[model samples]
Target: MGAPFEIGYVFSFLPKLLETLGVTLLIVAGSLLTGIVAGFLVALPRMYKIPVLRTLSGLYLSFFRGTPILIQLFLFYYGLPELLKPLGFDLSRAPVLFFVILAYGLHTGAYAAEMIRASVEAVDRGQVEAAYASGMTSYRAFSRIVLPQALAIAVPVFSNLVIALLKDTSLAFTLGVMEMTGKAQTLGTLTQHFFETYIALALIYLVISFTLEKVLLAAEQRLKRHEAREEKAGRSFKLRRKGSYRAVLADIDAGKGGRL
Candidate 1:
């Protein structure tokens, strides 16, 4: 007969699993940092329609997005070493965690590039025009005006990506990394309690995902509040401009009448 479910095993394994949580988080954090920077670089070319760069960026998106992440991991782990052997540089000697970061970062960056492009494009053209009319340089205008709005739009999407990447880090176990999943697997095998171990693992992931969702939601609300203030300020400026225009018109009429 199969062993009955033991709730105790779940609790017992929790600490062991948590011990490796740092590795999992490191992989996620490293990958995300790389992804954000790479994604932005990829996005700029596509955003500005820089012919050759745009094409290359599109191809990058296609190749990364088209393939499964597992395949990408394999390619980075195995194929990369083989490719580099001809150059007298050995990739195998490097840490597996580094390749995990590379694979996931490339994967995340492709999707992030598109998200960034969409968010930037979503900013109102009038906002850009106003920035230019205010004598702001292109870089200054974009950084001050366009980027703020685009980031607010992109934050929710990026939050989702964070959760996805967190889950994807489980695949690192396949590369022999003793991350959360790897630790869980060892505990489960030793204890002959696969179900309980997995339940604990799932709970850990759920807690992290839920916490991130809440944090991101709060950030979104704050951005909305800031945007509301900007809108109110804009209306006040328009009203003051209208009042000034009316006063100028009254003064011009008074001068004309006196002359007549």
Candidate 2:
């Protein structure tokens, strides 16, 4: 006889699975945080090139993106310790959690770099040039004029990256880091109720992922709407502020004021 799939199974086991949920969420949070910081650093070189650093950063992105993440994970978890020992680094006390984060960070950072660079580039060149012409230093111009616009452009890309990172957290289980999938596998093995365990796990993942996607989409839409409204307000203000200039020009051309 097969095990029944019922609400009882979920309610009963869900509390017991808190440890697994904690680990899974930790991996996702750790990876995304580390990856974004790495990516932000990588983005600088391309956005404002220091020739050698830019080349090196580009190489970093290319190599990571070109390789499979699973291989990268295996190499970091299995192979790097061997390499690091000779370099006089001790990895003995390091948990598998760190490797999961390292693998995810390097893999995701490569993609984030490209997305960020594109965002920075998407900023209007004229705005940057105007800042420079106004005596703003390169750094000042970038901070004030470039980065804000770039962030707006990058938000959508980053939201998707967050979703990808959420899914990729499952890979940690392969490395003996007992996250959600790992826990579910353990349950299935114990009870032989493969279908029940797996379906529940799938639903959990679906719920979390769907929730994050909706949040990101909502935030992205709000940002875009805010940007659009700001632009409209800026235009309206510029027109109103320059009313005298237009009125004078109209007076010169028409010999008198008609209706503004």
Candidate 3:
């Protein structure tokens, strides 16, 4: 018969798993920071339609997006050192966390580049033209007008990528990073309570993921509210202008009729 369920093991291992949750968060945070910066850089060429840069950016996306993340991690962790060896660089001495972060960052960056590109493209051209017509420089127009709108459009998609990155951080365990998944594995092996250990791990992940979703949803609603206010104000201004024009037309009619 299979080992009987030990309800006590779940509570016993919960703290250990929670302790490693911070490590998981660290991996996610590092990867996100690097990935976001890289993604923006990768997106620039595509957004501006630069000839050679766009071609290179497309290749970057194709390679990173097409490959599985695990393979990417291996490539970054193992392959980078080999290539850099001739340059007197030894990645083997560096902390595994560096490689883990690099791998996840590169992997996440590809998806982020596409998301950023799409978001930037989604911004209304009319708004951009209006900014330019108002004497805004290209950079100023993008920063003041296009970027804000693009960020709002990108947030929903970015939130999804954040969640995915959180889950993907589990792969860091392969590099001996004792993240939540790694800690859970250790607990499972030591106590021989696989199901209980994994259940605790799963719960921790679910709770964090749920919290992120709620926070992101709240931010999304706030952006929507701000947009709604701007739209309402625009409509109100238009209505007031229309009312003033009607009053002017009525005055003209009254003056003409009196003369008649």
Candidate 4:
């Protein structure tokens, strides 16, 4: 007989589930923040086509995008032990959590670098040239003119990658990192609650991903409305100022320029 999924088990496991939820968020957010920052730096250089860095970014992106993330994780977790032995570094002695974060960060960074580089290139060359023509330094042009628009374009794709990163946190179990999935697996085996355990875990993941997507969608809305806000505010301010000046001029004209 298929074991009935018990709501009571979920209620009992609530505290433990919440704790694991936090751990899942930690790994997801930590890796994404680190990866995006690193990717931005790499993408910036590649966008500028900097010497050697551009080619290196291209190669790095190609290699990571070309391979499965599972293989990448395995390489970092297993291969690193042997590879770093020559340098007197023992993987087993190192912080396993740190390696999990590092591997996730590097893997995500490669894809993000390529995405950002593409977004940067998609920005209008004329707009960038206009900034340069207006006496903007290359750095200033990028800061003020290029990044804002590139970021706007990249947000949707980046949102998808965030979801992917969250899902990928499951892969951490192989590296001995006790995250959400690890916790779930441990608890399931201990309690023999496979069906109930997975159902609850799935719900938790769904809730988290949904909440994150909502926040990202809200941010995207703000970004998309930015130009419209600026225009509306500018128009209103100009109209108010013009109306004030017109009233003053009309009063003076009505008095035939006499002091009043």
Each model's lDDT: 0.85, 0.78, 0.84, 0.77
- Stretches off by above 4 angstroms in model 4 are 88-90, 228-260
- Minimum summed lDDT over a 10-residue window in model 4 is located at 235-244
Task: Give the 10-residue window scoring lowest on summed lDDT in candidate 1.
Answer: 235-244
Candidate 3: 10-residue stretch with minimal lDDT: 236-245
Kindly report which residue pairs in candidate 4 clash with one another.
Answer: none
- lDDT string for model 4 (1-260, tens) is 33567777776665676687777788888888779887987787776779988888878778877898878888877778899899987787777777777778888898788778766766678778899899999989988998887777677778888988998998888877788888887888888777777777777878888988898888777775765686677742211112345344533424445443
lDDT for model 3 = 0.84
Please give the distance, in angstroms, between residue 52's alpha carbon in candidate 4 and its true position after superposition.
4.1
Model 2 TM-score on a 0 to 1 scale: 0.80
Clashes of 1: 0
- Residue 93 of model 1 has an lDDT of 83
**RMSD (Cα, Å) of model 3:** 11.6
Per-residue alpha-carbon lDDT of candidate 2 for residues 1-260, written as tens digits (9 for 90 to 100): 55666656765556556558888888888888788888988988887788999999989998898898888999899877888999999896689999889899878888888888877766667788899999999989988888777776677788788888878887778899889888987887787676777777877788888998788788777656756686677652211213346434532424434435
Which of the predicted structures, 1 or 4, would earn the higher TM-score when compared with the native?
1
Indicate which candidate wins on lDDT. 1
Sorted on lDDT, highest at the top, how do the candidates line up? 1, 3, 2, 4
Clashing pairs in 2: none
> Candidate 3 — which residues are off by over 4 angstroms?
230-260
